[model samples]
Target: MNYRLLIQYDGTRYYGWQRQNSTDATIQGKIEVVLSRLEGRPVEIHGAGRTDAGVHALGQVANVHLTERPAEEIRNYLNRYLPEDIGIIEVKQVSERFHSRLNASEKVYVYRLATDPALHVFERKYMTPCEEPLDLGAMKEAAAYLVGEHDFQSFCTKKMKKSSVRKLEEIRLEQLLGEIRITYRGNGFLYNMVRILTGTLLEVGIGKLSPEDIPAILEAKERQKAGATAPAQGLCLKEVRY
Candidate 1:
């Protein structure tokens, strides 16, 4: 039977959601190992997206196919076998044609920044600490420039295989206390696009880049011309919409 799973994880210890050929552990590898042991057979989990190392997910979706077991019991059984950092939030029987990666229509990502000198040790795992004050208005203006369909090659890493054009549905900036949250909704993204976008917005907030420069950067389509890619720890896969 085919089963769909809603997953959440802390990416601190894993090498990402995908399995790689390294001694370093991965979230997928760990879960597969646990599930294999439970069912006495190999099991594969297909994720909707691939998050880089140290990146987290709050509502990631995955599909798995298993035989000889009831689909509804998969979540409860996996929870007992999987590690603490990775949890199966929900499970349901899905059509055999349902593919987690191909069926996704849109995704929402969030980047968090702490704009204060004092660091919260606990929050360090999930937020980027910016000791400088952020210009809220400037950040909002810069975000507006990113809300449209554009060639996002400048914001992505060069290692991607697909086209760089993407439809950005929304870009919003919010400041609460010392934390700044940047929420982005898009049809798709190239590698590291969210991180680079966050860095570019931070540059605008810090007076290093003008809001008008965003359009020009998009026109350039050269990764070197864009701002630096921020650390992956502050990024989260907020949701996936079908």
Candidate 2:
């Protein structure tokens, strides 16, 4: 049976989601160790997406094939062996054909920014702190230009082999007490796409770039034309829809 898992993790100490032979300190590697021990055999798991180091996830999904174990028992057993920072929120049997990565229909990611000079002690690990004030209106205008389908080559790293064409369904920005949250809902994202876009928007908010420059930037299709990539700690995989 194929088991689907909803997982949450604080990625601060781990290397990343994908397992690496060079390092075993990864989310996937850690879980696989526990699962392999439970089943008395090697168990391979597939995740919905590979999140970078320092990136957090509240709704990460994965699928693993096991021999007819009770779902609740599997969840409880995994949780018992897993580290405190990683958790299996839900688990159930899925169809043989249901894949965690390929079957995903949409993904939502949120980048957080702390605008206040004095950083909140607890939020420092999760939010990027900005010393300068942001122009919210200008940032919104710039983000509007990125709402439709386009080749996001400018916003992605050059190390990617996949096509950069993607449809962005929504880009909503909300400001709370001392923090700024930018949420991205899209069919898919390229390598470091969301972080790069957030960095560009921050440039616009700080008068370094104008909202009118967004179209031309997109047209450039060059990574150099975009702003610097934001830090990974500020990014979080908020949701994945199948």
Best by lDDT: 2
How many clashes (backbone N, Cα, C below 3 Å) per candidate? 0, 0
Off by over 4 Å in 2: 117-119
State how far residue 189 of model 2 sits from its true place (Å): 0.8
Clashes of 2: 0
Q: How well does candidate 1 score on lDDT at residue 230?
A: 92
Best by TM-score: 2
What does the lDDT read for residue 223 in candidate 2? 95
RMSD, candidate 2, Å: 1.2
lDDT of 2 by residue, 23-141 (tens): 99999999999999999999999999999888999999999999897999999999999999999999999899999999999999999998873657787888898879899999999
Q: List the residue pairs that clash in candidate 1.
A: none
What does candidate 1's lDDT look like per residue over 1-242, in tens digits?
78888999999888889988784388888878877887789888899998988999999999888774666587888888787988889988889999999999999999988776265567888998887877889888988989999999999887457788999999988877778889999998888899999999888989999899999999998998788899898899999999
Query: How high is the CA lDDT of each candidate model?
Result: 0.87, 0.94
Which RMSD values do the candidates have, in order?
1.6, 1.2
Off by over 4 Å in 1: 117-121
